[model samples]
Target: MKSFWCEQAWLPDGIASRVLVRADRGTITSVSTVDTIPLGCERLYGVVLPGFANAHSHAFHRALRGRTHSDGGTFWTWRDRMYAVAERLTPESYLHLARAVYAEMAIAGVTAVGEFHYLHNGGNEMGEALRQAAVDAGIRLTLLDACYLAGGIGQPVTGVQERFSDGTGERWAARVAELREDGNTRVGAAIHSVRAVPRETLSLVAGAFPDRPLHVHLSEQPAENEACLAAYGLTPTELLHEAGALTARTTAVHATHLSTKDIGLLGSAGTGACFCPTTEADLADGIGPARELRDAGSPLSLGSDQHAVIDPLLEARGLEHGERLRTGERGRFTPADLVAALTNHAAVGWPEAGRIEVGAPADLVAIGLDSVRTTGCAADQVVLAATASDVAVVVSGGKVVARNGVHETLGDVGKLLKAVV
Candidate 1:
């Protein structure tokens, strides 16, 4: 059992002051207002929000962060460099790299991550490495095992792409079934893209895991849409709809190049859209219709895809900043909306998390109100003004995992990343 007295807390209804939160076995048991501080309860100052959820991630892509920018390449060219990194990773090396990368996420106030994993070296060795990495980093993991069968719409796997293929969709399912979930891990499914998974196998991958979260890389570049249309006469969103892939449990990553019809189809099905604003900008991918997708009935979430930047606060700020730049208007999304997207654990299959109320996971992030970036900001609007550096303390599963940019169990995250990267 553990207890914390918060100076300010983001409750479901609104922000509250002098709140007491109690937890037992990693779940919140009660929350109430208190006039006096209690003994033995940890003190958490400033505004404590629910821990952020990174909805879409490619953990191995962390290796390509600063190395890919010098050439000033396009997304296709970037893929060539990314492939170079993927080919060299063994399960042993991946565990070291992913452990360090997840530690970086932990200090950024990320309590849970949806790793869009596709780099399966012909078996579950890589997936098991990721599961253990998250455990060592003291965070929850949803290993979104991806099915990659084709190099393109009609192209066959070549080079390092061969490692991602499972020969058939049934074979992919059989291997994914071997992945077991424990207390810190959940197993989910991902369709690598409409380009990699063919028209016939889309439904097979979609229905393979009937009760888990499903994600897909949707229309990140114009060339993908062009190839998809030229081959099947349907946009990526339309193709997924045809295959019965869009649903309340589905999240379409990088919905940047969608048509109005594509947006409508995804919205009507209650499918979620996860925008990696920093990655989209880093890869020269245009700003997605985040406002349009939200208004169209699709829920919105955020990610650090590729880790050009790993700060969830920056990702949330970039989300609004991108909207303003797109429409020439400010305040496109409210601070509350950005916070909601930041803590959208449901997008990653943890429906009971991302809240501070009773029965939810006791994951909390304490942001210092007096930090250099957050001084003089309103309590409710700090999401707009703060960065990950303002994170004073991070609590996941009712345990303090990080403090002041330093991981609790792993020591210095920078040195860990320096050793691996």
Candidate 2:
């Protein structure tokens, strides 16, 4: 058993002061208000919020952070450069790189990550490397094994994209079935995009993991929409819907370019929309209809896709900021709404995580109230003002894995990232 006394904590109802949280094993057992500190209990100062869940990520993309910015290009052009990096990643090299990347996310207050993985390299070796990396970094992972059978609509796999293909959806499923999940890991499925997977195989990938989380790259680029429309005489969303891919357990990543009917189909199907605001802006992908998606019934989640940035707080902020820039309005999403999106563990298949209540995973992230970026901000509104630098302590599964941008076992994140990338 363990206990922690927080200066303030973000409870389900709202923020509370002098909060006491108790954990047994790796689950939070109780939460309450205590006037006095208890002996032997750890003290977490500042404002403790539920650990963040990164709903979409490509762990290997961390290597391309500063490399791609020197050139001007669209998402497709940036993707070509990304393929170069993907081509160089052996299982051994990827293990080292992914460990460092996951460690960076750990210090940034992400307790869980949904890796939108597609770099198969012929087998599950790369996926196994990722699972080990998450364990070493002290975080939970959902390896969303992707089915990438095509390079584009009506195109064959070429270049490094061949590494991501498993020949057929059945082969992809057979390989993924070998990936066993334990306490810290889960297995999920992903459609690389409407471009990467043919329409015939869409149902195979979506239905492959009927009981697990399914994520797909929706219309991230205008070109993708045009290509899908031209190829199928239907939008990508319509195709997915016709194939029975849209469902409650599905999440559409970067639904940036969507029709009114597309949004309605996704929301009415109870699907989730994961917005990668930083990546969208970095790749010049347009702002998505985040507010409209939520208003139409789809739950919203946030992701630091491509690792262009790794801060969940900043992702939440970017989500709202993108809304403001697009809608010309303030307070598009309330503070609570942003917090919910940041901590949406269910979107990644960990339904019992991302909250500080009993039965939830013992994940707590303390953000410094006195930091230069967060000073004078309201406790509830800190999601709007803070960054990863303000994270003082990150506790995942009842263990303190990181503090002050330093990992517990890995030491400084800079050195970890330097050693690999």
Candidate 3:
């Protein structure tokens, strides 16, 4: 059993003071809003918030950070370099890279992660090697094993993309079945995109994982939209709908170029939408319908996407930045909403996570209430002011991974990260 006594903690509804929280094994056992410190529990001061859930990520992409920025190109061109890096990763190298990257995320206060895993079929064991790497990294991974077939609408996977593709949806299913889930890792599916995947496989993938999380990249580029429209005679969202892919368990990533009906079907189908704001802006993917989707009551979450910037605090803030730019208003997104996106929206996208309420896993981040960022701020100010650097302590599953911004597993992540870049 472990207990945390804090001066302030962010409850689901709002911020409260003098909180004492207890955990047994991994789940929260007890929670109290009392000012008095407990007898034998560990005491930690400052502001405690729910551990941020990274809804989407590619762990290996952490290596390609600064290298991607120096080149000025579209997402397609950027992918070429990414593929070259992807080709060189062995299971051992991947584990080493992912361990260091997840440690970086822990330091930034991300308690759990949804790894959009696609690298598969190098060894005799296939992607089993890659899945094991995430388990060793100490972050809860949702392996979104992708069905990458075509290079584009008609082009076939040749060199590096061969690893991402199986013979067909049948082969993909056989491989997906090979993945065994553990407490820390859950296997999921991604349809890659209309460009890299066939439309027919959408049904095959989703139906196989009924009631499980299914994420797909939708209309991220104007070119992708035009191509899907030209080939399939519909936008990517409509094609998925026709193939019975969009459902309650599905999440449509970067629905940036959806039609009025596309957005309507998304909200009506109860599909979750994940907006990777930083990647969207960097790739010139254009402003997503953030306000529109929120108004339509679609569940919204955030993702680091390419690891261009791995900070969830900034990801939360970037969502607001996109909304503000579109609406010509500041404070467009409330602190409560952003916190939910960073925390509990993980629940909608990842049913296993999302909030800090009891019975939820004891994943949390503690920030200094008196830090320079929060010098004159209050509860809302905690989110408004704090950055990833201000995250002082990170606990995932009742185990302290980072304390005072120092990761216990990896020392000086920035210094190590530079080696790959």
Candidate 4:
């Protein structure tokens, strides 16, 4: 059993002072308000938030963070550089890189990550490496194994994309079926995109793991939508809807370029929209219709896709900032809304995580109210005002894994990342 006392904790109802949380075997057993600290409890100061869930990621892309922007280029040019990194990674090298990436996520207050992995290399070894890396770094992982079959809408696999395809959709399913879930890892499925997956195969990938979470990269770039429309005579969203892939369990990552009809299809189908605001901005992927998507019925979640920035706080701020810049109005999403998106563990298939309540995983993140970045901000407004540097303590699954941007057992995350990337 473990116990922790929070100065202020974000409860389901609202923020509560002097909150005492008790956990047993990684499950939160009880939460209550108390006036005095218990004798043996760990005390967490400042504002305590539920752990952030990075709902979309590609771990290997962390290597290309600062290396791809020397020359200004479109998303396609940036992807060419990304593919080069993917080609060089083996199972052993990827393990080290992902361990560092996950540790960096932990220190930034992210407890779980949904990796949209498409680097198959013709087997499950790469996926196995990612699973081991997550365990080593002390965070939960949803391996959203992506099915990438084509070079484009109708083109065959070419160049480095050969490593991403399993030859066919059936082969992809067989490879995925071999992946087993453990206490800290869940196996999910993803369609890389309408462009990468042919229409005939989209349904197979979506139905491969029906009981698990299904994610897809949806219209992140205008070129993709244009290509998809030119080939299929239907928008990407319409193609996905036609294939019956738009469901509550399905999440459309980067539903950025969408029409009125497309938004309705996603919203009415109850598909989640995961916005990687930092990466979208870094790649100049354009501002997505985040608020409009939510209003129409899609739930919103956040992620650090390319590792251009690994801060969930900054992603939250960027989400709202993008909305402000696009709409010329403030408060597009309230702080509570942002918090909900930040901790939506269900978006990554961890339905019982991301809450400071009984029966949930005992994941907690303590943000320093006294830090220079967050010094005078209101408790509710900290999401907008603070950065990852404000995170003082990160507890995952009832265990303290990181403190002040350093992993408890892995030592310095910066050193780990520096060695790998």
lDDT of 1 at 105: 95
Checking candidate 4 for backbone clashes, the offending pairs are none
TM-score for each candidate, following the candidate numbering: 0.99, 0.99, 0.95, 0.99
Report the poorest 10 consecutive residues by lDDT, candidate 1: 64-73
Better of 1 and 3 by lDDT: 1
Tens digit per residue, CA lDDT, model 4, 1-421:
9999999999999999999999999999999999889999989999999999999999999999788878898898999999899999999999999999999999999999999999999899999999999999899999999999999877999999999999899999999999999999999999999988999998898898899999999999898988888888899999999999999999999999999999999999999999999999999999999998999999999999999999999999888999999999999999999999999999999999888999999999999999888889999888989899989999999999999888999999988999998
C-alpha lDDT (0 to 100) for residue 419 of candidate 4: 92
Cα lDDT tens digits for candidate 1, 1-421 = 9999999999999999999999999999999999989999989999999999999888889988889878697999999989999999999999999999999999999999999999999999999999999998989999999999999999999999999999999999999999988899999999999999999999999999999999999999999999999999999999999999999999999999989999999999999999999999999999999999999999999999999999999999999999999899999999999999999999999999999999999999999999889889999999999989999999999999999999999999999998988
Residue clash pairs of candidate 1:
none
Off by over 4 Å in 2: none
In Å, residue 301's CA in model 3 sits off its true spot by: 0.8
Write one digit per residue (lDDT tens) for candidate 3, span 1-421: 9988867888877778888889898888888887578788766667888888888888788777777667587887888988998898877677667777777787898877776777875332434554565455455777777787787898988898888777688888787877877787777788888787787777788788775688888889899889988997898888999988888778888889988888888888878888888788877889898767777767888888888888898888888988889889998789888887788434324455555668888887888877777777776657777888788888888888787767776667776565544
Q: Positional deviation of 211 in candidate 3, in angstroms?
A: 2.8
Which runs of model 3 end up more than 4 angstroms from their true locations? 122-130, 345-352, 418-421
On a 0 to 100 scale, what is the lDDT of residue 84 in model 4? 93
The alpha-carbon lDDT assigned to residue 138 of candidate 2 equals: 98
